[model samples]
Target: MPDRAPQPVDRQLPTDEARDLISLVRDIAQHEIAQKAAEEEDAGRFPREVFTLMSRSGLLGLPYDSEYGGGDQPYEVYLQVLEELAAARLTVGLGLSVHTLAAYGLAAYGTKEQQTEHLPAMLGGGLLGAYALSEPASGSDAASLRTKAVRDGDDWVITGTKAWITHGGIADFYTVMARTGAEGPRGITAFLVPGDAEGLSAAAPEKKMGLKGSPTAQIHLDGVRVSDDRRLGEEGQGFAIALSALDSGRLGIAACAVGLAQAALDEAVAYATDRQQFGRPIADFQGLRFMLADMATQIEAGRALYLAAARLRDAGRPFARQAAMAKLFCTDTAMKVTTDAVQVLGGYGYTADFPAERYMREAKVLQIVEGTNQIQRMVIARHVAGPETR
Candidate 1:
């Protein structure tokens, strides 16, 4: 049976403008993204043009200030837009999330002159971005990263390797964190390096189980130099900036998880209603019906949790705990729900002919990115029960 169009989510948008924005996003997702998702992913093709279109449409800077060519929308609205795009394609959604994260250091900490000169192009001028924090030896222990930047006359020469960088080779710029002083987090500083910098290069993209359309690679900064003006915040401040960005970036991951789960649920439901057993639709079976119910409940709950966190951020409240909780819950939900979705389709779900298997593979990454679920638990525990004795 032919697949049916997935139903639109009923969202409680704060304003008419937000509602229209979602509607526009849905239209773009359905027409431009969803149709190509499966095919491109299968071929491991990144949709660079789609990102350019998003940049042109102002989707690239939804939560930033309008003064610098951003949409100036609140986090609540921005995250929902992420959810919608993710429902269509995770590469696009998570790519945008990584882009926002890459832009965070400068947007939140750069000098006024830096913002005026670079923010406009970064936000809306068709430039893509990557964040550089993780390294070959330091993934979760980001503070232990070995990348180093040395101050020259008027430039900082950075030398190191960054691993698992999204859009690694293709990005127009990178927000890099490197050691500049004593060891640990206090030694780190952030710099914005242009992709075309003479010494910047990327290794081949990783061969991943899913989200193949999104490039992940090792970015090499062999004496890559940038003017001192590209430094974000003061020296010894990059770790704090990275943490602040992750607090929000976690919410983005949460939203993407929910959207991926929603897509899986939608696929399962459509298949169940059409496939027959004992001359009746498989969806009518009590066991299968219960599974669908649980999947739907989890997706809805995940959506609500992420949105709540987003609202806290929008209101300027302390939401790091909530964000951690949301990321932990939503990603777990995605993994479970997508797995259940595959079970619903029985034999067919295991095959590449359907997207259930793809969804399952994609769902696994959410639990690992933007701070692993294990890290999320640690973050939450630190907030709730206080830091562990060491």
Candidate 2:
């Protein structure tokens, strides 16, 4: 007799609002998003239609206020929605989350006047966004970026290259961090650059191993002129705003990793029960059953970590360390779980016939991007031991 299929981890609802949001997200995931995920991923095609549907449904701005045309939902609710989307399609989920992060500088740190000017379009369904921070010379050491934004009377002329931009050419707006003063992080400042700005162009989308449907490319800004009114925050505040945005963004990635792991685990459990080997279902074997147990356990822990961090943030507490820990653990677990999922499928798992292979590929990227697991560890360790100790 085959072992029972693994059950979903118990979800602790943070609020009634979160529960309702999950139901809606799950419905959309099953009925709409899941339909084209496999085909689009295989063809390396972007899911523009899916994004349109998401935008129309108001999911694209869940964490923003309704006055700004947003859903006014809590981060907890927003993250669950992200999890459901990621379970169906990682590329779309990640792109949406990163877009939200790009909008954070304007939402959180932008002056009232700036927010009044930009938040409407940013939260509206039609606009898309990207963050311009990383560069060819600067990835982890973001302050080392060479992009320059020089002030000349009423306007600032930005001339530099932004690498690993998520939306790239597709975004309607970009939050760019460029040097305005000296050489260090404090000299950096953030600006909102419209996609159609003159002298701004995107390179060809990178050929990544996974998340290919979500275009990632370098953006070149050459003598692009914009009014000083476009600046997001005071001079030297760019690094602070970018780091704060990343703290929340890491939680989004953690949620995404959990969703991916859950999907892989579900596929593995379904396959193990149905697959026959040596006159018995593979799930009947204790060895395979234990592996499923481990996968499920790690997924539960991962979700709990992110949930804890989300709660901390909602309660107005310091959650940077918690978010880092969650991001590190969840992404690493995703890598391991998806690999085991392929092992569970045996030969069929290794092929495109099943999603486990693609899932494994997608999981690896999560561990690398949005601050590598190594960077996450450094963050956690620095917090654990004070700055002076480090």
Candidate 3:
């Protein structure tokens, strides 16, 4: 089936420029991205050209400083852009989010010299990035990561493996976290490692249920040497950097979830109205109509939740708890809405001939990525009920 134009979203944009930005994104998404999304996703082919076009069009660096070639748009605006892109292709929307997360360590923690040297190229020069923090043995307990970095003269030698890395093998640069001091959060330090560094290699990409077009692989750093100049922050501060990035990254994930759910709802609505049953549209049935209303409501609520968190983040206040809530609520909404969409489509939804199943599969990972929904609950509970004491 040919991909149709996305259903228009009544966005509450902050400014006239923001409105223009969303319109431009919709144009690119409908004309360039949505048309090929299904074909490329089914073929498991990465649309690198699309990313390059977005880079040139100034979409990749929307939330960062324009002094370094970013769009300088607020998180609210940037996230809405992600929503539009994700409705077209999850790989592209989520890829940009990961890239932004990868850039966060350096952009926020690095010295002036480092920012001046790297941010421009990373933001606008079409250089792709990857974040390397998750290890095979340390998924939830990220601070326990065994990736080691030891000081050797003016350089640091990095050795260990990073698993489930998005854009692992293809990134131009990596924002890597490695143990530098003791075996705890304070021991970790972040580094900006060149992709072509010696002794760095990637394993084969994982075969995934969805978002097959995006590569997820394990990266091995076998005594790869990095200079002190590339360190992101003070030694023993990588965990803090990672957490900070994730707060914003969660918002990105939330926005993407809302987008996916919106797409599924749009699909279901289109199908319900057009697919006739007993000479009347299924949309006339109260049960199906209620389901559609609930889906739309959930999508809107998810969108509002993420935007509220983004506003808090932009205002520079305490928003970790809110971010966690947004992640949990938005992703859960995506899962439910997509599944209901399949249900609305009946047997046809389960088939590859329709994109409903793909949306459901993709939504599964949103609950798992950035931080699992279970982890988000933990985070929120800490804020509300205090940290658990064993």
What TM-score do all the candidates reach, one by one?
0.99, 0.96, 0.99
RMSD for each of the candidates? 1.1, 3.0, 0.7
Q: lDDT tens string, model 3, 216-303? A: 9999999999999999999999999999999999999999999999999999999999999989999999999999999999999999
lDDT head-to-head 1 vs 3, winner: 3
Q: Pick out the ten consecutive residues of candidate 2 with the lowest summed lDDT.
A: 1-10
Per TM-score, the best of the predicted structures is: 3
lDDT of 2 at 349: 87
**How many clashing residue pairs are found in candidate 3?**
0
Off by over 4 Å in 1: 1-5
lDDT of 2 by residue, 1-390 (tens): 111222334566777776777777777777776777887777788877777777777878889878777887877778877887888788878978987998899988888888888887777756889999999999999989999999999999999999999988888899999999888999999999999999999999999998878899999999999999999889989999899999999999999999899889999988898989999999999999999999999998998889889888988899999999999999999999999999999988898878899999999999988799999988998898766442
| Residue pairs in collision within model 1 | none
